[model samples]
Target chain A: MVTINKPATKLNEPSKPQKSSSPSLTAFVKAFKNSIVLIVFILLWELAPQLGFVEKTFLPPFSEVVQAWWELLVTGELWRHFEASILRSLFGFLLALALAIPLGLIIGWYPLARDLLTPILELFRNTAALALLPVFILILGIGEVSKISIVLFACTWPVLLNTISAVKNVDPLLIKSARSMNISSFKLFYKVILPASVPTIFTGIRMAGTGAILVLIAAEMIGAKAGLGYFITYSQYNFLIPEMYAGIITISLLGLLINYGLSSAERYFSRWKQ
Target chain B: MDKIKFERVTKKFLVRDEYKKGAQREFTAIKDIEFSVKEGEFITLVGPSGCGKSTLLDLLTGLTQPTKGRILIDGREITGPGLDRGIVFQQYALFPWKTARGNIEFGLEAKGIPKSERKEKAEYYLDLVGLKNFADRYPHELSGGMKQRVAIARSLAFNPDVLLMDEPFAALDAQTRETLQTELLRIWKKTGKTIIFITHGIDEAVYLGERVVVLSANPGTVKKIVDIPLKDRLEDADIKSNPAFINARREVWNLLHEPEFQGAHI
Candidate 1:
């Protein structure tokens, strides 16, 4: 049967190959050229306030933010907040992965499950996870439970929807080919359907990873004593502009690290795609 | 007993009537399709588009049940797809995740063969298809011809007595197609499997088949079965251009077009 649904992302097509190889020096030069814009942007960020293009107190110089970041690291304050955020996001993400995948597979594969759950899923799918924050807070209280639950809620839909579509959209020809071998349904699911669904499922996983971080940060900002989000907002309230900038920078770096980790994992799983 | 049998089989699909609102109709794909194949014979089914050649194959593979009759293998009615028959599709449905050798091992694994023996068998068939060096390459890494070769090896690895090929070489370029055709004939001779090959091309049908079963389109049924008289056609390099090969090709082509011409007159 033909399944119609949008993919979470464009399938990860391999990038085109380089036309020719070059010396190590040339490769280093090319790498430098690629980073030119980023270097210029960083230079401008440092210069903008120093040259009075912006108010120094409101938007501190890049050097001051770096100094503040260094102090946070030295005092171990940043590590505490970082650890708390990481724990919440990781727990929520892992929890969502555990629940959503099997649920998605059932909904995708069996008509009974799909028919029963689809309407309720549609209602919840349309409702934003953040919008349910008050309900979560009201029910689970203003502790770790509410924050983690919100992150879990946010992460679940992307993983669930993408996985359902992934399993549904496996090439019918491959299924037919496997079926002709008189393979058991169990063998067919794992051998053909599961492997075929991996690339797309990983797409969902990566999206969930991003969502986990974003939601946990937001939840922390709304109410939390120790987290990057709390640290940033609290720093801003106390008129510690450089410390706030440091918190924001830390968050960006954390996002980058998370993205890099997930991308590497995706590449490892889909090595055969090359 | 015949190696495979199709006893007055018919298939119909329940389809939504596009021009009418909320209406359904039965679309008959093939009707009363009676045929039987002898052991160790290469039979090619040739037809125009919508001839239900594929439907016939689906029934034979037991992927779909016949709406009207029974299909049997070894004189026993087919319950469902089994290990006795293997199928190769034109699209080269090799799992992209599995390497060429892994794809071949899939069926053996389904048969619950031990890992070491499955690997040995996969390698043997990979060698048979002239893809020994490409055992570890995935389907996307291989060229079109190479992918099809791997698909053929995958189907053959399990050692099914009946091999059903649905235009397995149809997607290749002319040069590649002819090369694969020659290679297929060579493999058929080596394996001595009861082969049911399907194609829309007359030349392919005539070139490969010991006998060609021509099917007419629109409620497809067997129109005629023609035997090739050339004894050494497989060994003859110039057989396609040979007078006898041309005559047989012409005969199958005429059989395919006869219904169309009759419809035009009416």
Candidate 2:
């Protein structure tokens, strides 16, 4: 159990023996510290090349990577690559969400359905997501469908499993109270069960978003000509160190943006969690 | 017409656990109980835990089925829970997600009141409960006392003819419990709605009730019904100062200590 001290608001002393929790405000402090750490690492990386900590051919300075990024942006190459990667991840995420939630709700709501499906989902989920890339390429060709399908497969399990768990584990008291009020079962599912399961569902979505990004990038690296992954691989083979570093930076930025978008949404849906 | 009338009400609960030596244990919560409530009267049901005071309330609310009984209100059989019978649960069962106003609007919504009318009705109940300012706030934002008030507001929204409460204030601190009891009595007096309260606290039953109905433990049946005479139910005066209050509390407490009820608090 963890305890945290905070600015006191009430004069009353603790009446009950309970474990304390960290305050919400500390999250901002943690985030600020992380940014400082990242900046320090970047400053070190920039100076290492100049100090001959590594060969210049093998390593690029931070300024050179920024210059390559600027050139790519002007020529629309960076935008094309970034947009393709973003679109694939988004499309894959939406498809997985569409497939998972209702199926998860059914799987979660009924014991028989869950029993029939758990083994199949477990089997598929156990196989490494990347191993399916060749099979997908063989069936759909090395194109958008193949790359998006790979991402969709990777993202589906977490969303589906989380949704199932969320729906199954709603607070029993909420159900009892609603039933006592003569609330119809359908309305109970919509009003009480659905809303109660939201926090866990959001957790699944966050996982899916990150998983989709990782899978899409890996898939794109195989054959794609216009994506962040493709740019990184293409630049690496040609030994264009700065552009390769720029591609790595682009991937980092993409991940940061996606994490921010999903986390904020999680916050919005789980306002009552505290 | 009686606000509530239960005739030959016997409830049998099945203990379906296989480990029991027999097929199943038939534990009776309430047995051969019969009672009726007068219109607009406040009646309290006092008993040990699991003595069926709450089970009786649940039966009255149509939350559970009775094995053998007939429950009637105003002339019609109570087929299921309806707006006329509002129930306040022990745990402050206000929906966690909804604002105070949202909970109050629930019954009115079930009745299909117009949006504008429902809003007005919800605000009226909120004001009556002295929580008009907190209407927009969710249940999680409020303290335990505040949440119970919202639950009360929700129950009172439709001006239910018969309000059934199962130890609503028992979960609160002693101070909050006393304060809420006063507030509840004030609401009942102002609305003139019939109330059937269930509790184990003899003091609480005597403090808020117009009549305290005591029940014997397990296979529960009514033991006695003591009338409480308050000069002014609205005014917060010294109940202990009144000899009638003292006599009624002592009578009920003595009735609870009967020999048949020995070792019955299980």
Candidate 3:
């Protein structure tokens, strides 16, 4: 056996076992340092109304919003609306994914499909999803279908266009290499093309997820009985400012949670990239 | 019988001339090329940059069609890429997503080898390349030499009759190149598979090949074929400084600098 001696460098050395508990303490302190700006912002928000910089009835202090959020949580009313919104967004997003991915692959792979569908796609992609809300309500009768269709419309373009571009732009060298191996065309697509296009596809899926939430909330606000969007709008009309703030905060938190979930999935799928 | 035969093979490409729009020009990459490689022979094709060395390999692999004439392996015409020949590209075209063993198992998987057998074969080849411990490491995690080694292991794992290498060591440092050259000779001797290595380096061609086929540039054609007769050169550490090795190197160098070969140099 030939023994090839590599250079001695700390970079390649395996990590040593930690003998002290001090490192975890230091890491906790470092995390706090990173979040210092957010902490200060929350503190300033809490003090602004108490200092009379704004009227409490109009803007309400951060603490009052939290209290309203807690009361809603205790009564379990928020959970119902949250579950409804989550289900609508997820169902629409998944449906869009199922339709868009296969169509995108087809359009990207064959020039005939691209030539026939490109102009139509461009036209629909340019039109805003919210602009179609009234048309969808007219066509689908303002029920769950209209709301779901709005989310689907908003989410589809990004996922479809990105998948098309990803499939079209796979490295020619990779295809050449695989072809030289005498692999079948079907095997080439599944083994080489799909894996290679995954990172870019994930980018599109994450964008579609964000788009689904935004369109769903806007759709929910229009003639809806139960949703975070309806709750915020209804509370504002009833002069329950703290409840309105709580609803807005909930929506923001929901967006953050969706983003975190998508990013984690992206990381798991693309672990080989690093 | 010769393992590979090229009978009056010619290749032409249609290229758009940059200076004149709407005019397509026919550029001859190689013309009337005739050569044959014996089974288990180590042959090197050496030339200047645009001498169609890579195009020749492409034709051999059946990746591209010859404009005229035909190439035969074991007296049968090569229609397209098949399992009989394997190739190692300069870029090391390993799938970045796969680990070392996974990349090596790619061809076997294509052949419908079962998972257990594929794993065993992949491990065997990885060990042959001296990367047994690196089986689980991805391409990005390996160094340049390690990556090339993995690529070599991958090609060899498929057990093809002929191995076509296109300047496979040109990107490495001098030290690593020398090490790999020796390792390749060892592998070639062990496996006894026909190897057709393409390179521009005169010394590298002489060091590894039994016979070096030198091609002239404009419309690439064989200029000369020089035989290096040192039988046990790979066993010598200082073969480069040996007298016969120097004389063969000088001979090939003189052929490349001939007046007819001068204008092709940029």
Question: Fnat per model, in the order given?
Answer: 0.88, 0.33, 0.74
What digit string (tens of lDDT, one per residue) describes model 3 on residues A1-274? 3333434544445767655457656567768999999999888889999899988888888999999999999999899888889988988999999999888988988878877887888888788899999999999987888888888888899888888888888988889889999999999999998888888889999999899988888888886888898888889899999999999999999999999999999998888887
lDDT of 2: 0.85
Between candidates 1 and 3, the one scoring higher on lDDT is 3
Query: lDDT at A180 for candidate 1?
Result: 95
Query: Can you write out model 2's per-residue Cα lDDT over B131-249, one digit (the tens) per residue?
Result: 98888887878889999999898888877799999899989999999889989988888899999999989988988888888888678887778888866755647776678878888
In angstroms, the error of model 3 at B91 is 0.7
Assess each model's interface with DockQ, reporting 2 decimals per model.
Answer: 0.58, 0.28, 0.75
Maximum-TM-score candidate: 3
What lDDT score goes with residue B73 in model 3?
98
* Model 2 / residue A155 / CA error / Å: 2.3
- Candidate 1 per-residue lDDT, tens place, B107-213, comes to 89988899989989998999999999988887888999999999898888888999999999889999999989999989999999999999988888988899999
Clashing pairs in 3: none
In model 3, how many backbone clashes occur? 0
CAPRI classification of candidate 3: medium
Encode model 1's per-residue lDDT on A1-274: one tens digit a residue.
Answer: 3323423342225555545454455567777999999999888889999999999999988999999999999999999999999999889998999999988987889868777877887788678787888899899998999999998898888888878888889999999999999988998898888888889989989998888888888888888999999999999899999999999999998899989998999998898896
As a TM-score, model 2 comes out at 0.88
Winner of 1 and 2 under TM-score: 1
